[model samples]
Target: MQYDFDKIILRNGTNAIKWDGLDKTFGAADILPMWIADMDFEAPQPVIDAVVNRAQHGIYGYTEKPESFYSSISNWMKKRHGWQIDNKWIEVSAGVVPAISLSILSYSEPGDKILLQSPVYYPFFSAIESNNRVMVNNQLIYENHQYKIDFNDLESKLKTGVKVIILCNPHNPVGRVWSREELEKIGELCIRYNVIIVSDEIHSDLIFGKHTHIPIASISEELAERTVTCMAPSKTFNIAGLYTSAVIISDDTLRGEFKNTMNRLNAEAKNLFGIIALEAAYTYGEEWLEQALPYLEGNLDFLVDYFITKIPNIKVSKPQGTYLAWLDCKELGMNQKDLVDFFIHKA
Candidate 1:
């Protein structure tokens, strides 16, 4: 079946966080709403069909996650990323953000330092601060039009007794698919410091070109023991509203801690529809994802060409993964506030 990604559907009345709050988020309703991470396209027919089929049943009761859901997730991981994830290691959460919050609570104590690479997904900051933990930034070194981890800085931060490192693998905004060598270096640093790594691989499947996402936990047995890998079909299948995400903890001790935290907070159960949508997406949404990546790449290319040829003052660092385009408007000779105003007016 042919996918129509270019067909922009009307989302104004759907209570979409992207479209509904345009004026509130950007200070104007006229701006093109590209700032949010979710896509503009509808999810695959298979996903929609599954949700609709479940809705038809009309039995909204407390539900248990089936064995098929776990199997689907494991199969998808092995097939797409060459990662062998056992069913026993998986923990369900409402979303990755919640999982991050829970990880902070489970693994670290108050006043402990949690390391993050910036300028990252803004929520990483909140996840740290909201839990009464100190946020330490090992800010990425931006050089040669790409973002690279500063290992020396990371080591320094680790030495200061940071308990955890939250990584945005195939990172957001300033997109850079972390290489194997980079992942290894990070793994080494975390191991050396005895710090836990929370690898958010939410965008792992959204990669473009020859770029590949490496799960930090899958780096090695020792790294796996220290890493908590968070993944979901939400971003890939455009199903964020479903609130289904998987947290893979390879180590039994860490997994037990995470599970205990979730159980204590009563956050372990999956949403009924979330399970249905997740299973369908992972099992049948592969071809849809495969097709979507090329269209997104085209969109990135179009945006780059448009910015270069037409909007010469604005520079977009071409993304390695994810649909988000980090636009550099410093050349517009305007301050950050002015640039935002200009885009709001122009968009």
Candidate 2:
């Protein structure tokens, strides 16, 4: 079955933030908004069917993540990334951001320093500071048209008594999938420093050609204990609105603490549709992903070539994973306001 990557689904009336909310967000309805993270294409038919089946039942009541939910997700992880996860390790959550906040709350204390690689997802900052924790940056080194971790700076910060290191594998904005060596180096540092690692692997499934997504915990049992891994089909299936994700913590103690935090927040129940959609996605969306990936690679290639030939000034980061691209506009040399205006008004 060939999937339609080029088919344009009308989302303008669907309250999609990427489309319908553009007027409210950017103050212009006609800017061809591309700032949001979701794709313009529809989710897989299996996912649609799952949600529709649940919807047709016509009873929206309290829902829970069944054992099958964990089994389905576990199977998907094993098959997709070769990471074996037990059902006990999976904690259902509304989304990755909430899971991060919960992990931050569970593992670290207020005013305690936590580390992040900067120019990351903006919510990471709020997840730390809003919880009254200090945000530390072990900034990534950007040179030769790619990004690399500054391990020395990371170690220096860890030595200063950082409690938790929030990691974004297949990093956002700058989308280089962290190499195994890089992951191990950071893991070793965290272990030595007795710091917890909250790795956000939300975009793990969307990896491009030749790049693999490695679950941090899968590196070793010890590292797994020290890590809180967040993942979801939200990004992969374009189901963010459904708000379901898994926080995989293989360590018994860490899993307990994170679950305790979720219980405290009263977030244990997932919506009926999200539960069905997640199961449907993991069980039957493999074929859809097989088709979608090549289309995504083509889109990325086109963007790269267009920028190089037509714009020549703006540089777009070539992502090894995820559909989102980071545009490097440093060469434009305009102030932030001017840059915003350039895209919103001029470009």
Error of 2 at 319 (Å): 0.5
Candidate 2 RMSD computed on C-alpha atoms after optimal superposition onto the true structure? 0.9
TM-score of each candidate structure, all chains considered together = 0.97, 0.98
Residues 95-190, model 1: lDDT tens digits: 999999999999999999999999899999999999999999999997876788888888988999999999998898788999999999988888
Candidate 2 per-residue lDDT over residues 1-347, each given as its tens digit: 68888897788788888888878987889988788898887899999988888899998988767789899999999999899999999998989999999999999899999899988999999999999999999998989989999998899899999999999997997998998999999999999999999999999999987889998889999899899999999989888898989889888999999988999989764778889999999999999999998899899999999999998889987799988888988899999999998898888
lDDT of 2 at 175: 90
Off by over 4 Å in 2: none
Lowest lDDT 10-residue stretch of candidate 1: 338-347
User: Would you list the C-alpha lDDT of every candidate in the order shown?
Assistant: 0.90, 0.91
